[model samples]
Target chain A: MTTITQGHAAQDHAHDSHGPARGLSRWLFTTNHKDIGTLYLLFALVMLFVGGGMALVIRAELFQPGLQFVNPEFFNQMTTMHALIMVFGMIMPAFVGFANWMIPMMIGAPDMALPRLNNWSFWILPFAGTILLSTLFMDGGGPAAGWTLYPPLVLQSGNSLAFAIFAVHLLGMSSILGAINIIVTVMNMRAPGMTLLKMPMFVWTWLITAYLLILVMPVLAGGVTMLLTDRFFGTSFFQAAGGGDPVLFQHIFWFFGHPEVYIIILPSFGIISQIIPTFSRKPLFGYSSMVYATAGIAFLSCIVWAHHMFTVGMPLAGQMFFMMSTMLIAIPTAVKVFNWTATMWRGSLSFETPMLFAIAFLFLFSIGGFSGVMMAIAPVDFQYHDTYFIVAHFHYVLVPGALFAAIGGAYFWLPKWTGHMYDETLGKIHFWLSAVGVNLTFFPQHFLGLAGMPRRIPDYATQFADWNAVSSVGAFLFGFSQLMFVYIVVKCIRGGKQATAQVWDNPEGLEWTVPSPAPYHTFDEAPLIK
Target chain B: MTTRQDIDPELQRRIRRNALMVGGFALLIFVLYIVAVALKVAG
Candidate 1:
């Protein structure tokens, strides 16, 4: 790979004719990858705050368990909307933002293969998000059926259900289009010497993730469309009165849903892989094995969907099959964790803010993974299913696991994106508050779940009050700490110390070969990787 | 430095072909899902 050098001055001058167009049209109509990436990141940030606010409402109501803030119905709406917004609106788009910004650059291409399609993919999100959020003000309020949108209970929702379903269809379209773009770009656009194996981990994971999306997103769209028909068109796809089976809905939803977990996390594994090697100042351990492990995890994810519905009742042999399949996922997941840990072993480790978050992810995501394994047992999940333990498990995975890696990736790349260094001192402060606040908020929920305090309730038994209160306090601390992150990002973008071309020491990839704050149009001429 | 035109024509054709195939497959999955669900409900 080419080393970072200050040779882009002449190229920058040559590309001035193709610099960003003036004003709003630059963002609206242009297909430049960097501009589109900025749009995705900014949109995800807004959704993060919007979703985080709903979470605070949930916590405040559960602070003492007597419906302190909102009615039970509205509280259910909050829970439902929170998961939907976080999963669909925030996390997925943020990774797409990363893919948009880095993939073309890493592979030494000018832009996504389908640039207009890229534009369309991003433009769809805001409208979809607006339709979703607008449901809160509808006559009967937003979708209260949880993000899963299981039938029967979901069918009981009012007019907002149709609007919510429409919004989901739009969101799925955006993902499908976006995934197609990534797959095409990665398959087609690599530089002359950049073989598939030599491509960065981020690109490889996303390639796998893009395939997973293409496969499962259509299933989700179909499932929700069935929900729509059942409610409106008098179809009984999930309604028992018309001889339809509700359990079938669970089977369909979790088919998309389980892989959806891997969908959210596989790119996070990619991000951590990139960050750990850079900070540790060593080549990634077992590079080929890591690739195989990711593919293994993706394949296993498709088969293990039934594990989520063990409590719904299946034959014993069926239960055993799902249980064993779910357990098998642990092998590949363990390989990734082992590879990350082995990457850091006896290396020149430093705790910069990004590295700090990566380390925290390694520790905390494992906690979530272990909880996942515990629940994988068909018998044990009967007790744990739909409890706060399930909540704790996913929150640990998403919040610290996926979310932390995104933050670490942002910090790692912010300098390259903005051409200015973020305030390191403040970044550290953000990390510690977040690290402490996330743990304090989530750890006790494990106890609450084990203690039989169910999830999605407005009120609970008196015995569960203490941990609930503690978890609430931690929630606010974590929520407010994110504002510091926003501040640091804005501060960096506005300007600080001007960064060198290689912002971090000896980070590998074609992205670093370009100038800092990479030019509006990069690699109009592809670089030979070797 | 190789511009888009400078790249091999055969490679570009392959890229176009692959993209069409992938996009078609996604559309097929979506339509197939609706069909399968419809058949199940009808039965």
Candidate 2:
């Protein structure tokens, strides 16, 4: 691997061709993958704070005996929009950002396969999100019918519904385009020697995720379009009166939504796969199996959408089949979990911030997954469905699971992205605070849900007060803990200790071969795969 | 990078197969929806 110092000639080369366009046009016209990646990441970070603030409001409203903070209708809107924003606006975009920035580097390509289309895909997001968020302040209310947008109830929702349906179309459109870009880049633009199996885990995960995005995003777009027409254009695509079954709407939505959950979490698995190996000073265990399991899970995702709607009065045999199919996902997911542990077994393990989050992810995510399996049981889901237990289960899965892995990934790759090391003391503090805050926030909701507290209500029955108080306190702590994340990320970007080309001691991959704070355009020259 | 012919033929074939399968599945879903709607009308 050749490392070129930024001599005057390279600096001259850099400034000469890539002329300054001041602020707006640089982001608009430039097709640089890193620039687009930065756009995605920055968008996600801003939206994270937005979503996080919504959670606090939800918690604050639920903190006491009566509706203290907001009305029940407004509270419902917050939960609905919060879920939508975090899933599509924040988590998905962050992972896509990682893909844009790192896939080419890992695969030895200089830029995304369709760079102009990439810019177009990203630029659609802000406008789409604006349209959706705008619904909150308009007449009746936002799409308060929950993120699922189950028909009948969703049908009677406020005037904001059409805007949300269109907004979802725009979001899904962006995702599909972004996924296609990743797919083409992976398939067509790898360096000379990097084979499919030999590509980095992050690239592999994004490859599968891109496939998931393409297949299901259009299904989602079609479903919402039907909803739009059903509501306004006098079509009966989802209305029973028009010969459209409500259950069929579910079938279409879950066909999209179930895979959408995987869309949220798959890249986290890839991040953990990469980080576990690097921090443990071991090659990823069952690397081949990891790839197979990821693909296996993706394949299974399409078949298991019906599991989410187990209560819709399908045939008993159908229920049994969906229940069993959902359970089958456990096999591949367990493979990933066990492999991460095996990779960490007795190697030169150090508790860096990244590794700390990875370890927390294993325990917390597994707890969430175990509960998830319980929820998969048709009878058990009858008890737990639409309860705070369900909320606890997914927040656990998403917060520590996907979101923690994201922070870990950000910490792990920070040195590579910036030419400096973040403060270890601060990083570790942020991780610990986040872990504590995560547990504080999510654990009590389990009791509330199991105690028969239903979700989305601004006011709870008196029986639910104690656990609700505990949960509220946890929410406040969790919200504040994220401020530390914002600080550390900013501090690192400004300046810190100069990082080595290989930031971690045992890290392996093409990314380490580049200089720290990877050059503006990387993977330009293909490295011969050893 | 050299053209696809220069690399392993097996890998290229596998790539082509994966692409075809994914594309075929998408097309199948598209066709299934059309059939479902048609059946709803005719039945």
Number of the top DockQ candidate: 1
Model 2 interface RMSD over true interface Cα atoms = 5.0
How far residue A85's Cα lies from its native spot in candidate 2, in Å, is: 0.6
The 10-residue segment of model 1 chain A with minimum total lDDT is: A1-10
Per-residue lDDT tens digits of candidate 2, residues A1-530? 21222211211233234433578989987788888888999899999999999999998888787979788889989999999999989999999888988887787776776788899999999999899899999898899989989887899887789999988988887887788778877997777667888887888889999899878887777677777777888877778887777787789889989888889889999899889888899888888899999999999999988888887888999889989999999999999999999999998998899999999999999999999899999988988978999999999999999999889999999898888999999999988888888898899899999998998889989999888888889888878888888898899999999998889894888778777888876643445664
Measured against the true chain A, the candidates' chain A TM-scores are: 0.98, 0.96
How would you encode candidate 1's per-residue C-alpha lDDT over A340-370 as one tens digit per residue?
9999999899889999999999999999999
DockQ of 2: 0.14
The CAPRI-style docking tier of model 1 reads medium
Q: Which stretches of candidate 2 lie over 4 Å from their true place?
A: A1-21, B2-43
**What TM-score results for chain B when candidate 1 is compared with the true chain B?**
0.82
